[model samples]
Target: KEPKEQGDAKEQGNDDNSTEEPVTAISEDNVKDQSIPSPTPPTPPPQ
Candidate 1:
């Protein structure tokens, strides 16, 4: 499988989350996928 830089890893991460119960990691990845540097907080995990 491709190394899925970060964005893709996030998708899989979210999917894996529901199965693994790591919502925090999913939220963190969502933030990282947005604006790269603007991965602040309170604005991610809307998907």
Candidate 2:
């Protein structure tokens, strides 16, 4: 019984870890995709 319980706990831990990589990858891609520089400030009217 103890061994079965341990196995179940380990399986659940692995499942939690498995989802982290994809989420991290997606967030990183989103940041990279928005790397464009902000638009230049509008030029002031000629003095």
Report the number of the highest-lDDT candidate: 2
What number of clashing residue pairs does each candidate have, in the order they appear?
0, 0
- Which lDDT tens digits does candidate 2 get at residues 1-47? 99999999999999889899889999998877666322222333332
Q: Once superposed on the true structure, which residue ranges of model 1 sit more than 4 Å away at CA?
A: 1-21, 37-47
lDDT of 1 by residue, 1-47 (tens): 56657778798878876876667778888877876756545457664
Cα shift from native, residue 20, model 2 (Å): 1.5
Residue pairs in clash, model 1: none
TM-score result, candidate 1: 0.30
Error of 1 at 15 (Å): 16
Off by over 4 Å in 2: 35-47
Question: Worst 10-residue stretch by lDDT in candidate 2?
Answer: 38-47
Model 1, C-alpha of 28: deviation from truth (Å): 0.2
